[model samples]
Target: MSNVTSGDRRVRRHLTAEIKSSLRDLRNQLSMLNRQVGIQLDLKDIDMDCLDLISRHGPLSPSTLARRAGLHPATVTGILDRLERAGWIARERDPADRRAVTVRALPDRGKEVYRLFSGMNSAMDSICADYDEEQLKLLADFLRKSTDAGLTATRDLSASGA
Candidate 1:
Protein backbone atom coordinates (compact mmCIF):
# COMPACT_ATOMS: atom_id res chain seq x y z
CA MET A 1 0.00 0.00 0.00
CA SER A 2 2.82 2.42 0.87
CA ASN A 3 4.65 1.55 -2.35
CA VAL A 4 1.50 2.16 -4.33
CA THR A 5 1.00 5.54 -2.69
CA SER A 6 4.62 6.49 -3.39
CA GLY A 7 4.31 5.54 -7.05
CA ASP A 8 1.03 7.43 -7.39
CA ARG A 9 2.60 10.55 -5.89
CA ARG A 10 5.49 10.34 -8.30
CA VAL A 11 3.13 10.01 -11.25
CA ARG A 12 1.07 12.98 -10.17
CA ARG A 13 4.15 15.11 -9.56
CA HIS A 14 5.63 14.17 -12.92
CA LEU A 15 2.41 15.04 -14.73
CA THR A 16 2.11 18.42 -13.01
CA ALA A 17 5.73 19.32 -13.63
CA GLU A 18 5.51 18.32 -17.29
CA ILE A 19 2.40 20.46 -17.75
CA LYS A 20 4.02 23.49 -16.12
CA SER A 21 7.16 23.14 -18.20
CA SER A 22 5.21 22.68 -21.40
CA LEU A 23 3.13 25.78 -20.72
CA ARG A 24 6.29 27.83 -20.14
CA ASP A 25 7.86 26.50 -23.29
CA LEU A 26 4.76 27.25 -25.32
CA ARG A 27 4.59 30.81 -23.92
CA ASN A 28 8.23 31.43 -24.85
CA GLN A 29 7.79 29.97 -28.30
CA LEU A 30 4.68 32.07 -28.94
CA SER A 31 6.42 35.24 -27.74
CA MET A 32 9.14 34.63 -30.34
CA LEU A 33 6.58 33.84 -33.02
CA ASN A 34 4.61 36.99 -32.16
CA ARG A 35 7.71 39.10 -32.75
CA GLN A 36 8.43 37.39 -36.06
CA VAL A 37 4.84 37.49 -37.17
CA GLY A 38 4.62 41.20 -36.47
CA ILE A 39 7.65 41.94 -38.64
CA GLN A 40 6.72 39.51 -41.38
CA LEU A 41 3.12 40.67 -41.61
CA ASP A 42 4.08 44.35 -41.59
CA LEU A 43 2.15 44.74 -38.36
CA LYS A 44 5.23 46.00 -36.51
CA ASP A 45 3.78 49.44 -35.83
CA ILE A 46 0.22 48.22 -35.53
CA ASP A 47 -1.04 47.53 -32.03
CA MET A 48 -0.94 43.73 -32.08
CA ASP A 49 -3.46 43.27 -29.29
CA CYS A 50 -6.04 45.03 -31.44
CA LEU A 51 -5.17 42.97 -34.49
CA ASP A 52 -5.31 39.76 -32.52
CA LEU A 53 -8.70 40.56 -31.03
CA ILE A 54 -10.07 41.53 -34.40
CA SER A 55 -8.63 38.48 -36.13
CA ARG A 56 -9.92 36.02 -33.58
CA HIS A 57 -13.29 37.54 -32.80
CA GLY A 58 -14.21 38.70 -36.28
CA PRO A 59 -15.43 42.23 -37.08
CA LEU A 60 -15.95 44.19 -33.89
CA SER A 61 -17.57 47.42 -32.81
CA PRO A 62 -15.01 50.18 -32.26
CA SER A 63 -15.92 50.35 -28.59
CA THR A 64 -15.69 46.58 -28.22
CA LEU A 65 -12.37 46.51 -29.97
CA ALA A 66 -11.07 49.28 -27.74
CA ARG A 67 -12.12 47.41 -24.61
CA ARG A 68 -10.58 44.16 -25.73
CA ALA A 69 -7.39 45.79 -26.92
CA GLY A 70 -7.11 47.82 -23.72
CA LEU A 71 -6.97 51.04 -25.66
CA HIS A 72 -9.11 54.14 -25.53
CA PRO A 73 -12.02 54.27 -27.97
CA ALA A 74 -10.42 57.28 -29.65
CA THR A 75 -7.18 55.38 -30.08
CA VAL A 76 -8.96 52.41 -31.64
CA THR A 77 -10.80 54.75 -33.99
CA GLY A 78 -7.52 56.32 -35.04
CA ILE A 79 -5.96 52.91 -35.66
CA LEU A 80 -8.99 51.82 -37.64
CA ASP A 81 -8.77 54.98 -39.69
CA ARG A 82 -5.18 54.17 -40.61
CA LEU A 83 -6.00 50.58 -41.45
CA GLU A 84 -8.88 51.72 -43.62
CA ARG A 85 -6.73 54.25 -45.39
CA ALA A 86 -4.15 51.54 -46.06
CA GLY A 87 -6.85 49.39 -47.74
CA TRP A 88 -6.27 46.59 -45.28
CA ILE A 89 -9.56 47.04 -43.45
CA ALA A 90 -12.95 48.64 -43.85
CA ARG A 91 -15.80 49.84 -41.69
CA GLU A 92 -19.47 49.44 -42.44
CA ARG A 93 -22.65 49.91 -40.53
CA ASP A 94 -23.62 46.83 -38.59
CA PRO A 95 -26.72 45.26 -40.05
CA ALA A 96 -28.29 44.59 -36.70
CA ASP A 97 -27.51 48.01 -35.38
CA ARG A 98 -27.30 50.64 -38.04
CA ARG A 99 -25.94 53.12 -35.54
CA ALA A 100 -22.93 50.95 -34.86
CA VAL A 101 -20.07 50.38 -37.26
CA THR A 102 -18.12 47.18 -37.66
CA VAL A 103 -14.55 47.01 -38.86
CA ARG A 104 -13.55 44.07 -41.01
CA ALA A 105 -10.43 42.75 -42.66
CA LEU A 106 -10.34 42.88 -46.46
CA PRO A 107 -9.59 39.43 -47.85
CA ASP A 108 -7.16 40.61 -50.50
CA ARG A 109 -5.05 42.57 -48.06
CA GLY A 110 -5.27 39.70 -45.61
CA LYS A 111 -3.87 37.38 -48.23
CA GLU A 112 -1.10 39.83 -49.02
CA VAL A 113 -0.19 40.02 -45.36
CA TYR A 114 -0.06 36.26 -45.16
CA ARG A 115 2.05 36.11 -48.31
CA LEU A 116 4.55 38.55 -46.82
CA PHE A 117 5.00 36.29 -43.81
CA SER A 118 4.94 33.03 -45.74
CA GLY A 119 8.67 32.50 -45.41
CA MET A 120 8.78 32.52 -41.64
CA ASN A 121 5.48 30.71 -41.47
CA SER A 122 6.92 28.13 -43.86
CA ALA A 123 9.80 27.59 -41.51
CA MET A 124 7.32 26.99 -38.71
CA ASP A 125 5.51 24.59 -41.00
CA SER A 126 8.75 22.76 -41.65
CA ILE A 127 9.36 22.40 -37.94
CA CYS A 128 5.91 20.91 -37.54
CA ALA A 129 6.48 18.59 -40.48
CA ASP A 130 8.58 16.28 -38.33
CA TYR A 131 5.63 15.61 -36.08
CA ASP A 132 3.06 12.99 -37.01
CA GLU A 133 -0.57 13.99 -37.36
CA GLU A 134 -1.43 12.78 -33.86
CA GLN A 135 1.51 14.59 -32.33
CA LEU A 136 0.58 17.76 -34.21
CA LYS A 137 -2.97 17.50 -32.93
CA LEU A 138 -1.69 17.04 -29.40
CA LEU A 139 0.51 20.08 -29.71
CA ALA A 140 -2.41 22.11 -31.02
CA ASP A 141 -4.54 20.95 -28.14
CA PHE A 142 -1.92 22.04 -25.66
CA LEU A 143 -1.60 25.39 -27.36
CA ARG A 144 -5.32 26.01 -27.05
CA LYS A 145 -5.30 25.04 -23.40
CA SER A 146 -2.36 27.30 -22.73
CA THR A 147 -4.05 30.25 -24.39
CA ASP A 148 -7.24 29.69 -22.44
CA ALA A 149 -5.33 29.46 -19.21
CA GLY A 150 -3.38 32.61 -19.95
CA LEU A 151 -6.54 34.52 -20.76
CA THR A 152 -8.21 33.32 -17.61
CA ALA A 153 -5.20 34.23 -15.53
CA THR A 154 -5.11 37.66 -17.10
CA ARG A 155 -8.75 38.21 -16.32
CA ASP A 156 -8.29 37.12 -12.74
CA LEU A 157 -5.27 39.33 -12.30
CA SER A 158 -7.10 42.30 -13.74
CA ALA A 159 -10.10 41.68 -11.53
CA SER A 160 -7.82 41.74 -8.54
CA GLY A 161 -6.41 45.08 -9.71
CA ALA A 162 -3.03 43.59 -10.33
Candidate 2:
Protein backbone atom coordinates (compact mmCIF):
# COMPACT_ATOMS: atom_id res chain seq x y z
CA MET A 1 0.00 0.00 0.00
CA SER A 2 3.04 2.30 0.50
CA ASN A 3 3.94 4.45 -2.49
CA VAL A 4 7.55 5.19 -1.36
CA THR A 5 10.15 3.14 -3.23
CA SER A 6 12.69 1.14 -1.20
CA GLY A 7 15.60 3.20 -2.53
CA ASP A 8 13.89 6.47 -1.64
CA ARG A 9 13.10 5.20 1.86
CA ARG A 10 16.71 4.11 2.32
CA VAL A 11 18.01 7.53 1.31
CA ARG A 12 15.57 9.27 3.64
CA ARG A 13 16.60 7.06 6.54
CA HIS A 14 20.28 7.72 5.85
CA LEU A 15 19.76 11.46 5.77
CA THR A 16 17.70 11.37 8.97
CA ALA A 17 20.43 9.42 10.75
CA GLU A 18 23.08 11.85 9.57
CA ILE A 19 21.00 14.83 10.73
CA LYS A 20 20.60 13.32 14.20
CA SER A 21 24.34 12.72 14.47
CA SER A 22 25.11 16.25 13.36
CA LEU A 23 22.68 17.65 15.93
CA ARG A 24 24.36 15.68 18.71
CA ASP A 25 27.78 16.94 17.69
CA LEU A 26 26.52 20.51 17.52
CA ARG A 27 24.97 20.25 20.99
CA ASN A 28 28.17 18.92 22.55
CA GLN A 29 30.33 21.55 20.88
CA LEU A 30 28.02 24.38 21.94
CA SER A 31 27.90 23.08 25.51
CA MET A 32 31.70 23.09 25.66
CA LEU A 33 31.81 26.60 24.27
CA ASN A 34 29.27 27.86 26.82
CA ARG A 35 31.26 26.24 29.63
CA GLN A 36 34.40 28.01 28.47
CA VAL A 37 32.57 31.33 28.33
CA GLY A 38 31.20 30.82 31.82
CA ILE A 39 34.68 30.05 33.14
CA GLN A 40 36.14 33.15 31.55
CA LEU A 41 33.37 35.28 33.06
CA ASP A 42 33.85 33.67 36.48
CA LEU A 43 30.14 32.84 36.56
CA LYS A 44 28.35 29.63 37.36
CA ASP A 45 27.12 27.77 34.28
CA ILE A 46 23.50 28.27 35.29
CA ASP A 47 24.06 31.93 35.91
CA MET A 48 25.55 32.32 32.47
CA ASP A 49 22.58 30.50 31.00
CA CYS A 50 20.12 32.72 32.85
CA LEU A 51 21.93 35.85 31.72
CA ASP A 52 21.81 34.61 28.15
CA LEU A 53 18.08 34.06 28.38
CA ILE A 54 17.59 37.48 29.92
CA SER A 55 19.63 39.16 27.21
CA ARG A 56 17.76 37.48 24.42
CA HIS A 57 14.27 37.86 25.88
CA GLY A 58 14.73 41.45 26.97
CA PRO A 59 13.03 42.55 30.19
CA LEU A 60 11.47 39.79 32.25
CA SER A 61 9.99 39.34 35.71
CA PRO A 62 12.03 37.20 38.10
CA SER A 63 9.35 34.51 38.01
CA THR A 64 9.32 34.49 34.21
CA LEU A 65 13.09 34.30 34.16
CA ALA A 66 12.98 31.37 36.58
CA ARG A 67 10.52 29.54 34.33
CA ARG A 68 12.58 30.17 31.24
CA ALA A 69 15.80 29.04 32.93
CA GLY A 70 14.07 25.98 34.48
CA LEU A 71 15.36 27.08 37.85
CA HIS A 72 13.72 27.81 41.18
CA PRO A 73 12.69 31.38 41.91
CA ALA A 74 14.99 31.44 44.95
CA THR A 75 17.90 30.21 42.89
CA VAL A 76 17.13 32.84 40.25
CA THR A 77 17.11 35.50 42.95
CA GLY A 78 20.65 34.61 43.96
CA ILE A 79 21.73 34.55 40.31
CA LEU A 80 20.13 37.92 39.78
CA ASP A 81 21.89 39.38 42.80
CA ARG A 82 25.24 38.13 41.55
CA LEU A 83 24.59 39.39 38.03
CA GLU A 84 23.45 42.74 39.39
CA ARG A 85 26.66 43.11 41.39
CA ALA A 86 28.68 42.18 38.36
CA GLY A 87 27.03 44.96 36.31
CA TRP A 88 25.45 42.50 33.91
CA ILE A 89 21.82 43.15 34.81
CA ALA A 90 19.61 45.69 36.54
CA ARG A 91 16.72 44.82 38.80
CA GLU A 92 14.13 47.53 39.14
CA ARG A 93 10.50 48.20 39.91
CA ASP A 94 7.94 47.76 37.16
CA PRO A 95 6.26 51.02 36.24
CA ALA A 96 2.87 49.40 35.83
CA ASP A 97 2.98 47.97 39.34
CA ARG A 98 5.51 48.96 41.96
CA ARG A 99 4.98 45.57 43.63
CA ALA A 100 6.30 43.78 40.57
CA VAL A 101 10.01 43.75 39.64
CA THR A 102 11.72 43.75 36.25
CA VAL A 103 15.12 42.48 35.24
CA ARG A 104 16.96 44.06 32.33
CA ALA A 105 20.21 43.02 30.72
CA LEU A 106 22.94 45.66 30.81
CA PRO A 107 24.42 44.85 27.43
CA ASP A 108 26.51 47.98 27.44
CA ARG A 109 28.46 46.54 30.34
CA GLY A 110 28.61 43.12 28.70
CA LYS A 111 31.16 44.10 26.12
CA GLU A 112 33.54 41.47 27.41
CA VAL A 113 30.99 38.78 26.83
CA TYR A 114 30.57 40.02 23.28
CA ARG A 115 34.33 40.15 22.85
CA LEU A 116 34.70 36.58 24.04
CA PHE A 117 31.98 35.38 21.68
CA SER A 118 33.30 37.35 18.68
CA GLY A 119 35.44 34.49 17.44
CA MET A 120 32.56 32.08 17.34
CA ASN A 121 30.36 34.71 15.70
CA SER A 122 32.95 35.29 13.02
CA ALA A 123 33.28 31.58 12.42
CA MET A 124 29.53 31.25 12.05
CA ASP A 125 29.47 34.13 9.58
CA SER A 126 32.21 32.46 7.55
CA ILE A 127 30.27 29.19 7.49
CA CYS A 128 27.11 31.01 6.40
CA ALA A 129 28.96 32.58 3.49
CA ASP A 130 28.73 29.40 1.45
CA TYR A 131 24.94 29.35 1.58
CA ASP A 132 22.68 31.26 -0.79
CA GLU A 133 19.76 33.29 0.60
CA GLU A 134 17.25 30.52 0.02
CA GLN A 135 19.53 27.93 1.58
CA LEU A 136 20.11 30.20 4.56
CA LYS A 137 16.38 30.64 5.01
CA LEU A 138 15.92 26.88 4.91
CA LEU A 139 18.69 26.41 7.47
CA ALA A 140 17.10 29.00 9.73
CA ASP A 141 13.72 27.37 9.42
CA PHE A 142 15.15 23.96 10.32
CA LEU A 143 16.94 25.35 13.37
CA ARG A 144 13.83 27.19 14.57
CA LYS A 145 11.63 24.12 14.21
CA SER A 146 14.23 21.94 15.88
CA THR A 147 14.43 24.36 18.80
CA ASP A 148 10.65 24.35 19.17
CA ALA A 149 10.63 20.54 19.20
CA GLY A 150 13.30 20.45 21.90
CA LEU A 151 11.31 22.90 24.02
CA THR A 152 8.18 20.83 23.61
CA ALA A 153 10.04 17.70 24.66
CA THR A 154 11.33 19.49 27.75
CA ARG A 155 7.83 20.58 28.75
CA ASP A 156 6.40 17.11 28.13
CA LEU A 157 9.23 15.40 30.02
CA SER A 158 7.76 16.39 33.38
CA ALA A 159 4.70 14.28 32.71
CA SER A 160 6.69 11.20 31.74
CA GLY A 161 7.78 8.59 34.26
CA ALA A 162 11.54 8.18 34.12
Candidate 3:
Protein backbone atom coordinates (compact mmCIF):
# COMPACT_ATOMS: atom_id res chain seq x y z
CA MET A 1 0.00 0.00 0.00
CA SER A 2 1.42 3.41 1.01
CA ASN A 3 5.15 3.70 1.64
CA VAL A 4 4.74 6.62 4.01
CA THR A 5 5.00 6.29 7.73
CA SER A 6 2.24 8.15 9.61
CA GLY A 7 4.69 10.46 11.42
CA ASP A 8 6.71 11.08 8.27
CA ARG A 9 3.57 11.79 6.27
CA ARG A 10 2.38 14.36 8.77
CA VAL A 11 5.80 15.99 8.88
CA ARG A 12 6.02 16.20 5.09
CA ARG A 13 2.57 17.70 4.73
CA HIS A 14 3.28 20.30 7.41
CA LEU A 15 6.62 21.19 5.90
CA THR A 16 5.19 21.56 2.39
CA ALA A 17 2.49 23.95 3.58
CA GLU A 18 4.97 25.88 5.70
CA ILE A 19 7.34 26.25 2.75
CA LYS A 20 4.59 27.63 0.52
CA SER A 21 3.49 30.14 3.13
CA SER A 22 7.04 31.20 3.87
CA LEU A 23 7.76 31.78 0.19
CA ARG A 24 4.67 33.91 -0.21
CA ASP A 25 5.53 36.05 2.79
CA LEU A 26 9.13 36.43 1.70
CA ARG A 27 8.03 37.46 -1.81
CA ASN A 28 5.70 40.11 -0.46
CA GLN A 29 8.38 41.46 1.86
CA LEU A 30 10.85 41.67 -0.99
CA SER A 31 8.35 43.46 -3.20
CA MET A 32 7.69 46.08 -0.57
CA LEU A 33 11.38 46.54 0.15
CA ASN A 34 12.16 46.93 -3.54
CA ARG A 35 9.49 49.59 -3.87
CA GLN A 36 11.02 51.47 -0.99
CA VAL A 37 14.50 51.17 -2.44
CA GLY A 38 13.29 52.42 -5.80
CA ILE A 39 11.67 55.46 -4.25
CA GLN A 40 14.72 56.33 -2.19
CA LEU A 41 17.06 55.93 -5.17
CA ASP A 42 14.84 57.95 -7.54
CA LEU A 43 14.59 54.86 -9.74
CA LYS A 44 10.84 54.55 -9.92
CA ASP A 45 10.89 51.66 -12.42
CA ILE A 46 13.81 49.65 -11.17
CA ASP A 47 13.67 45.89 -11.59
CA MET A 48 14.72 44.27 -8.34
CA ASP A 49 15.64 41.00 -10.04
CA CYS A 50 18.18 42.69 -12.29
CA LEU A 51 19.67 44.58 -9.37
CA ASP A 52 19.93 41.35 -7.42
CA LEU A 53 21.81 39.62 -10.23
CA ILE A 54 24.28 42.44 -10.72
CA SER A 55 24.82 42.80 -7.01
CA ARG A 56 25.74 39.13 -6.67
CA HIS A 57 28.01 38.45 -9.66
CA GLY A 58 28.71 41.62 -11.57
CA PRO A 59 31.47 42.16 -14.09
CA LEU A 60 30.13 39.07 -15.81
CA SER A 61 29.06 38.71 -19.43
CA PRO A 62 25.40 38.92 -20.38
CA SER A 63 25.39 35.16 -21.05
CA THR A 64 27.03 34.39 -17.74
CA LEU A 65 24.68 36.80 -15.97
CA ALA A 66 21.70 35.09 -17.61
CA ARG A 67 22.78 31.73 -16.22
CA ARG A 68 23.50 33.15 -12.79
CA ALA A 69 20.24 35.11 -12.69
CA GLY A 70 18.23 32.13 -13.89
CA LEU A 71 16.95 34.19 -16.79
CA HIS A 72 17.22 34.02 -20.58
CA PRO A 73 20.23 35.65 -22.24
CA ALA A 74 18.07 38.10 -24.20
CA THR A 75 16.30 39.14 -21.04
CA VAL A 76 19.64 39.75 -19.36
CA THR A 77 20.71 41.84 -22.34
CA GLY A 78 17.57 43.98 -22.07
CA ILE A 79 18.15 44.52 -18.36
CA LEU A 80 21.79 45.40 -18.97
CA ASP A 81 20.81 47.85 -21.69
CA ARG A 82 18.52 49.66 -19.29
CA LEU A 83 21.06 49.60 -16.47
CA GLU A 84 23.76 50.92 -18.77
CA ARG A 85 21.50 53.68 -20.00
CA ALA A 86 20.74 54.56 -16.39
CA GLY A 87 24.51 54.94 -15.84
CA TRP A 88 24.43 52.39 -13.06
CA ILE A 89 26.48 49.83 -14.93
CA ALA A 90 28.92 49.47 -17.80
CA ARG A 91 29.88 46.72 -20.22
CA GLU A 92 33.44 46.23 -21.38
CA ARG A 93 35.08 43.75 -23.73
CA ASP A 94 36.97 40.99 -21.98
CA PRO A 95 40.70 41.68 -22.30
CA ALA A 96 41.64 38.13 -23.16
CA ASP A 97 38.50 37.32 -25.16
CA ARG A 98 37.71 40.17 -27.50
CA ARG A 99 34.46 38.54 -28.53
CA ALA A 100 33.12 38.43 -24.99
CA VAL A 101 31.72 41.29 -22.93
CA THR A 102 31.61 41.79 -19.21
CA VAL A 103 29.19 43.90 -17.20
CA ARG A 104 30.38 45.94 -14.24
CA ALA A 105 28.61 48.25 -11.83
CA LEU A 106 29.63 51.88 -11.48
CA PRO A 107 31.41 51.73 -8.18
CA ASP A 108 30.00 54.98 -6.81
CA ARG A 109 26.46 54.06 -7.79
CA GLY A 110 26.92 50.57 -6.50
CA LYS A 111 27.99 51.94 -3.15
CA GLU A 112 24.82 54.00 -2.94
CA VAL A 113 22.65 51.02 -3.80
CA TYR A 114 24.51 48.89 -1.31
CA ARG A 115 23.79 51.49 1.35
CA LEU A 116 20.09 51.27 0.60
CA PHE A 117 20.09 47.48 0.75
CA SER A 118 22.24 47.41 3.84
CA GLY A 119 19.83 49.71 5.62
CA MET A 120 17.03 47.25 5.14
CA ASN A 121 19.24 44.31 6.04
CA SER A 122 20.42 45.98 9.20
CA ALA A 123 16.91 45.92 10.61
CA MET A 124 16.69 42.20 9.89
CA ASP A 125 20.08 41.61 11.46
CA SER A 126 19.10 43.51 14.57
CA ILE A 127 16.09 41.27 15.03
CA CYS A 128 18.36 38.24 15.05
CA ALA A 129 21.17 39.82 17.01
CA ASP A 130 20.13 38.08 20.19
CA TYR A 131 21.53 34.86 18.82
CA ASP A 132 25.18 34.03 19.39
CA GLU A 133 27.68 34.02 16.51
CA GLU A 134 27.69 30.24 16.22
CA GLN A 135 23.94 30.16 16.21
CA LEU A 136 23.88 32.82 13.52
CA LYS A 137 26.34 30.82 11.45
CA LEU A 138 24.12 27.75 11.72
CA LEU A 139 21.13 29.80 10.67
CA ALA A 140 23.05 31.07 7.66
CA ASP A 141 24.09 27.54 6.71
CA PHE A 142 20.49 26.36 6.94
CA LEU A 143 19.30 29.20 4.73
CA ARG A 144 22.05 28.52 2.17
CA LYS A 145 21.09 24.85 1.93
CA SER A 146 17.43 25.70 1.59
CA THR A 147 18.19 28.16 -1.20
CA ASP A 148 20.35 25.60 -3.03
CA ALA A 149 17.67 22.93 -2.77
CA GLY A 150 15.01 25.32 -4.10
CA LEU A 151 17.21 26.25 -7.06
CA THR A 152 17.91 22.61 -7.83
CA ALA A 153 14.20 21.80 -7.77
CA THR A 154 13.38 24.66 -10.12
CA ARG A 155 16.13 23.59 -12.55
CA ASP A 156 14.92 20.00 -12.50
CA LEU A 157 11.34 21.03 -13.15
CA SER A 158 12.34 23.22 -16.09
CA ALA A 159 14.47 20.45 -17.57
CA SER A 160 11.64 18.00 -17.24
CA GLY A 161 9.26 20.37 -18.98
CA ALA A 162 11.70 20.81 -21.84
Best to worst by lDDT, what's the order?
A: 2, 3, 1
* Error in Å for residue 159 of model 2: 3.4
> Which portions of model 1 miss their true places by more than 4 Å?
1-46
| After superposition, candidate 2 runs with Cα above 4 Å error | 1-3
Report lDDT per candidate. 0.77, 0.91, 0.80
- lDDT, candidate 1, 59-140, per-residue tens: 8888989877667798988888877777767789988889989887777766765675677789989999999999999989
Of the pair 1 and 3, which is ahead by lDDT? 3
Q: Candidate 3's residue-wise lDDT over 16-65, tens digit each?
A: 89977997898798889888888887664434566667667777778888
- Candidate 2 lowest-lDDT run of ten: 153-162
TM-score for each model: 0.71, 0.93, 0.78
**Clashes by residue pair, model 3:** none
In model 3, the runs with Cα more than 4 Å from the true position are 1-20, 39-46
**Alpha-carbon RMSD of each model:** 3.5, 1.5, 3.7
* Candidate 2 or 1, higher TM-score: 2
